[model samples]
Target: MSKFSFPFFFIVLLVGSSCKEERQNDTAENFTEFVNPFIGTGGHGHTFPGATAPFGMVQPSPDNGTTGWDWCSGYHITDSIISGFGQLHLSGTGIGDLADLLLMPTGKTLDVSLFGTTRDSLPYTSRFSHSSEIASPGYYKVNLESNNIQVELTANEYVSFHKYTYQNTNEPSFVIDLGYAVNWDTPTESSITLESETQIVGYRHSTGWAKNQKVFFVVETSEPIVSSQFMANSETLDSKNEAKGIKTGGQFFFDQDSTKTVEIKIAVSSVSIANAKENLISRGNSISFDEVKSQTNNKWEALLSKIKIETPQDSLKTIFYTALYHTQIAPVLFSDVNGEFRLQNDSIDSTQDWNAYSTLSLWDTFRAENPLLNILQPERANDIVQSMLAYYDEQGRLPVWTLYGNETNTMTGNHGVSVITDTYLKGIRGYNVDKAYEAVRNTMMGDIRGLAPYKKYGYIPYTELDESVTISLEFAYNDWCVAQIAKDLGKEEDYKYFSNRSKAYKYLFDTDTGFMRGKSGDGKSWNEPFDPKFSSHREHTDYTEGNAWQHSWFVLHDVPGFIELHGGNQTFTKKLEQLFTESSEISGENVSADISGLIGQYAHGNEPSHHIAYMFNSAKEPWKTQYWVRQILDTQYTQQPEGLSGNEDCGQMSAWYVFSSLGLYPMNPASAQYEFGSPLFEKATIAISDTKNFTIIAENTSPINKYIQAVKLNGESLQRTYITHTELMTGGTLEFEMGPDPNKNWGI
Candidate 1:
């Protein structure tokens, strides 16, 4: 057997043996059952329990009858009815869009007005209970109470498979609502065309977080349509080749036996309608819904098997696996089956052999999700880097909150630098580093979005830019990543330039207040009337969706520098202590709802404070890091539908949980180093490679005995407070002795 493959097999076998028999079974049965997709569907989790393959373009899930904050992903547990199953969705995001090509099937006698322009007006929308609903990795099923129809959804890479079983109707009708949009999204234009009796094609252009977004789809049904009608803005038109308007809808009446199921495949593409059809034809011709579901389940099992923790606590396992599931939901496959994708300005791109990807919440993912991918899915990580480079090649800069081939530029910082640099430093080679470096250097040196003033002055001036302090701090971290890439590429001058620029964050650090605050144009004085606890909800604020207490510790590249600026470890650690123990209250006119899941002022729900708990390691207070990390892990995450304390932010929040639960975190993602924290699990094994396994074993590990007494790597005493990625990938056992009290001397 290959060397790396043995360890993965060992982990699988060992986990199988150690876990309880009821929860331990075949690879697919045990692990798949533990996944609770509904955990984040309720509350503000904004996650969809949809049927989607790993990084697939199609997210076929039920949209609830609402356009509220919790329904960002189109589905919320609190909602009373399912509007329809859309072929697209967003998981754990603040803004909601892409609930495109919504398909609702019911009995032929149902009124068309019952399915209205908005979900709230749809009286025919079916009610579904959690007891009858089922969701796994790439599958979702629900029984609609409106017409007593059972809906089952599954997906491949680019197409969604939907099976509808009507209980008493011999003739079933389906409505395609191309105009349907939810939360912070609006469909500018939409089109639906009847290609044949059994086939249909359409497109929807939208404006939202992704401006100028376009999605083309080709849907094919098992049974031929006996009759069809087109409707636009409440006006019904005779069947035609095409129907185009702002509010376009299509109704297809199908001939099917009452007992037999009617299945349909919807293929989606950002490229073109023909490409969408080609995608469906290429992959959907021979595959059955069950086969597609099985394939998707196996895909998740293989990915989840990369890290196997030997624990009897099913709740922890459920949370870990669900978090792992969230990480694969984005950086989706943009390229179609023929390796074609839409480029900037609605053009076609067919440059590479590897598939292109998008939906990069880089501002969030660069912290932990991307780094986690570098460990668990290095191949995909390399592809994602290439995709970013490809985006740079087209758009002349890396994407911010990009989706559907559009650079949304929604968030701050050119964080694609961090993602690229982190992967490069980990030795994940595939993409062109010189070109990558060019993109990174250009992004840092670009004259757009206050970078000119940021370069002219030491930092971005509050008078010139919004979120000046946060931008400067985030850009400093981005610059540090650029510096690392430059140094590795042997560009001494570039390294020197970015290295100097990386320290520009020091200019915004208010020495008197001990918080990073916005500075004036002269850089001699801070912005006036600064309340560190106050977060201005306006766009023209010093912070972005965060207060000073949260963004103050964002200097991921230089925690030591941050400590020095805060008057040494004693004062620095005390500030961190206060950040945790302080009141969970904010003083502001309009505070950001993104700042939830609060522990004192440490908002675990947002990305800004993600690394703060681990920052205690650098402050020489490892126990505090252990205490807070454990506290957040236990309190912020749960097995319920509203278990998440904050937005999933794609997978950043969940990724943090996965890493912290395992006693490791990527404090500085650009560096290969991972700061150590208290491990929540008793024994965990990571299949690093085919020939190696990195095992983490915590003895006497429990709720009370959460403190680490001692640590040994490969039976050798470990003195460092952090571990490197190289050391982890090389494979060895890291054993931790646990106790109720912290060993204070450990790692010191």
Candidate 2:
């Protein structure tokens, strides 16, 4: 028997007997302790280090001021000065917006004029050290050196709680900034009113990616407010009615002394102030700070327990759980306690049966994040599809990249179709299938964006629109998703039509260059002066965020057809090899920051090339896929602040990590099959449902054991390159014996 395995039972130990004592001592660490909230706060990770429950709408995190771009989440690890804690924030996104309801603690005697209402100056900001900061899964703490104050933050589903400790100060004040907008955000109107002496209720209307975004909040404090003042653009406002401006906030002085602590709770809603107050009273109050923290941690533990792994490496556990944590940050719960949520039409939805959820980020998430959720969180998956259907009911079409009851129309393709179809095919049937089908077909059949041109010409023409090539390719994949649903629904005619439309990727294939290139509107010839490696900074280009090399293999729905187009597997394998062995340099005049984390021409940082490594399965080179998958897992992710390679893109980047680290990749995200790669852990137990748990064990596994030697499913010999979602849900053990060298005959 291998050192990592037990003889009688199928329990997974370590690789050696010497590590038994080490494992015994490490049993006290909860899964939450392995989560480092700061992993993606630095560099281009674009993740927020905040206190939030799983999929909670409230995110209370310190903002270090923003210069746009890297400050998408309103927080950066490089900045030492924290202006305030924003109740709402973005996670791992390319654009920034929600930094709503900024609250900052200040010394009562501090000069207000020096700071002003804006965070552009001193009094509103304070420098803090990382040494005094503590961040776990659902809690965050930091000390401001300038004010001798300590701030701790925690959250429930819709409400956020703040605890402030003052030392050597008799007077303490909390600044409530209602109109403080972050990057790409402009506040049009805002209002704040002192309801009694201990409560404030208001709303802020802004224009940004979501266009007409409205956020209402109800803030209540444990202490009484002795005095209050309102300001707009740093000037004191005498108007008690409403304050309207780009910069508006309030200052409330509390009756407190030295070494005193005050607690505050804020509940927010997109519907109305009444719902916000209801949310606050129902979910936030009647819970102590420690109880809130404890309950939040318990919620995180319950969520993390869905996928349990036994490993001796602390680094592996940290990275795995952190990646999993990132996957649950978005697709936020948008419904209130009464199932009340705002719709895209600026009206309230009072539906009691279906709950609404926003933050789809469909362009990025349709790749893997939503697919992972289909497996781990099937019920939430159903709710997410229902939420998209709700948007479809509100608007004429499905959401491209939605948030807070608005469609940003960012990125490309009818990708929501991919998410819906993938979720439905995974055997999750909690949504209305007819409505989903209608929404899916409407995205393709509607004459919106470039879909009309794609249908008319079999592909979008470059002269007709920019990014015509990638848009056509993505639309083709989405059409494939629609076709799958059509086939499942017994609509044979629709299935045939959509299936034919799904092959539109072939029109852009420049047979001479073996790359998917752009063609003019007339379809007589390809676009002139085509540089396959060239991409724009952020504007119109032949591709979305990548060049032709990365976009070539994006046809994940038809890798076999792609291989056939290249003659056979031999030529296809050679071309696939070139994607990782070609020139490593990118030569565009103004390249995008998203086109990073490069391994040769294959960019892992962005979503385009995510499934490229796993395509080796179709080329009869699964070992190469294993080698590169392990390489990307080790080199691309880390336990540090700047651990990620690029924008976590909501959670797609981390979803790729979570799926690939477990020795599987959903090559076709809309399909139920998972392509095998190299498993990083010795054992992983997945709780598929309430009554079943699936376990995957790797025997004789180590750092050098990157290839599979043999495999067994529940002690029966297994010989397949893919596993079905149904098989995984049946509750069984999949064991693989690992060796230092490739046993190519095992799965092939």
Candidate 3:
């Protein structure tokens, strides 16, 4: 037995025995049972069903192959093959990257000649069936039919635990492929060193969505490695212990044992291999696989238990909790246990006072996910803002899309400004507010992503940039967020400047077509030959992942002005009604696949139209808001593998479901107000804070009774269609009397 194996096994036995009795007596609810990690994996949802703690650094998930759009998360439900299990993965992203440090267990040794030195080539592959697969909040298990090996995976914040049970196999080997890459990811450099018989350390530096991604890892196995072959660039190296090149890997043969079980623990760090080793020693060295699984289960239970719902159907409960589970999967922990992390400038920062986070998909998340985080996970939200501020301090701009420690500068607008403004306005001031404001201001003032032309033309013109209308509208909303922060900081002049800038969306609104059309740089006329339903995928279009009908409602911060732009409340509501009742057909040679969950032209699958359903509240047509909110809640989300209507987009889609299912949504996410919607549950108790509990009760709620007839907050009748964030945080009961028919006069 290896020296590390005996102590680890002894500790496992001791801890398991000691905790058995206590665990039997404990009757805490297991919220993980309600979460189906596979709910979004089948469709364009792009979710991976794997082992990961809430915002965990290590995601030890199976990768199918490094090809195509469905393989964004490294695995798709449609694929039955497994290339290997990777340490890192992106959940529900449109673009793909980061399936680093892949390891595959096989019954036979791999032929190095059969593998090619590219992201697409697989050293070892296996077929797996869904019937033999099981996934929960922090655990994933699959039986590989090709190798007849049962693979079980679990993870904590920093380490991933893998246990492989060989079935009737003579040869049991592991192929640790450092060269493995998927989708947009390409390994720039990689290396592996066998530190000892049972220990291996390596690093994979890659480029893709995250321009400069670095992942350093330490691997420890329970069984002793009897023989090893190191390979680089598809060639076996003369050196037995180490290989260094752009493409590198190692195949290790473990000693045949009667136990037939091999356990592996992998710890990752963004800083260095030393930090990775330290992380494993501190976090994973002594813990058993079952113990780690139990710990991660408890952690997820605690977070998921924060919001408890009593629904009529078990499936609804599953769907609701699954959505909640998806919301906590990103902006994952970036700082190591010792407060060491890689800064944006390719330097290490060891002085971080708090946990740093990455995977900030600001364009999608700023709409709902960040707002939901401010309420549910305020402490982490503060850390996220701090991380963004750190990025700004190093790179002189807030992150557009950050993964690991690299900024991708993806998507559009200064939505990071919106996330910071929302976090600060929500009173989660754990971060430096002044520095945050400076980041927001500096980011907005920068001449990038069409900002220069936007400043000159008031709105981005089609002549100056593609996706002009979409960029202008999103920037306007972000400008409104900046205005709010400036106003709160008592910078009146700056506030006035940004507040005016916030109205830039009006420049693109063409009264002739009643749509926000792209304008020419001359500002004399709108871009000609426009169609509201025309959309182009990643082309020179005025919209991004959406058409005019969707981008026109991007003015979430100034709904009143937007309503006036349509002439009046009646006209506005009519146009708003048309958005959901018009033709759902989109016309283009290459229409964006993101325009899914179509209720007419209101694409619920995407972010731009997320708040559109609640716009009727401002128009005094509260019943319409309630009706459409319920419609979306019922149809857009489900419990099956292809459940989600679109890409979860790092939790924005799920966050929308979470808030809307609770009968409220952030129409303007930074506004600190939640507009009323149709609640899906009979009753939901939200542990708003450690001490405060906010409960929502829907009396006589059923499938038919989807509309609110009356409303009450704590025993008094509520007249407004919206509630303030302060009201919710203070903790009270918000009751809704539901009926088959809408009470048009209720909130109005």
The parts of candidate 1 lying over 4 Å away from their true place are 1-29, 109-116, 256-259
TM-score of 3: 0.95
What lDDT is reached at residue 504 by model 3?
95
For lDDT, the strongest prediction is 3
For model 1 the TM-score comes to 0.95
lDDT of 2: 0.83
TM-score of each candidate? Answer: 0.95, 0.95, 0.95
Model 2 lDDT per residue over 1-748, tens place: 0111012111122232233424423346577877778878888999988899999989999888765788999988788889889998889999998888889988765443233234665466888987777788888888998889999999988899999987776678888776566677878888788887788898888888878888999989888877776777667777643455656677778776533788999999998999999998899878878888899889998888788877778668778999999999998989998899987679887655766789889989988899888888887888888888888888888889997889999988888888988888887878778888999998789988898889889999998888888899999999999999999999999999999999998888876788898898777698878777787854668888888888888797898898888888888888888988788777777787788888888888888888988888887778888888888898889876778998998899999999888878888988888888889888888988888888989887777998888778889887787788888888899887888998777766
Stretches off by above 4 angstroms in model 3 are 1-29, 116-123, 257-259
Candidate 1 global Cα RMSD: 5.0
Give the Cα lDDT of each candidate.
0.83, 0.83, 0.87
Error of 1 at 212 (Å): 1.5
Using lDDT as the yardstick, the better of models 1 and 3 is 3
For model 3, state the Cα shift of residue 578 in Å. 1.0
Report the C-alpha lDDT of model 1 over 1-748, residue by residue, as the tens digit. Answer: 0111223323443574365544443343446656767778877889998898988888899988587788888988777688899988878988787788899887764444333377666535777765667788898888888788999999988889999888886568788887777887788888899889889998988888778888999999888887777777666766555678877877788765533578899998887898998999898988888889888888877778888887657667878888888888887888888888887687788746687888888888999999999998898998888888878888888777777788878788889888988999999989787898889889888889778988999689999988998889888988888888888878899889888999988998887988989889876988889888998764758999989999888888988888999999999999889999999999887898888999999998889899999988888889888888899998999767787887887888789988999999999998899988889888888998888899999998888988888889899998778889999889999998989998888776
Expressed as tens digits, the lDDT of each residue in 1-748 for candidate 3 is 0011122323433563344322111133466777888878887899999999999999999888848887899988788899889989898999999888998898887765334354335657888887778788889989999889999999999999999999987788888887777678888899899999899999999888887888999999998888888888878788889999888888888876654899999999999999999999999987899999989998998999999888646567778989999999998999999998997678887645689999889999988899988988898998898888888888888989988888888898888899998888989999788889999998998898899999998889898898999999989988889999999999998999999999998898887778999899878787768889999986879999999999888888889899899898899999999999998999999999999989999998888889999999999999999899999998898766678999999999999999999999998989999999999888899998788899999999877998899999999999899898899998999999999998888887
Residue pairs clashing in model 2 are 4-14
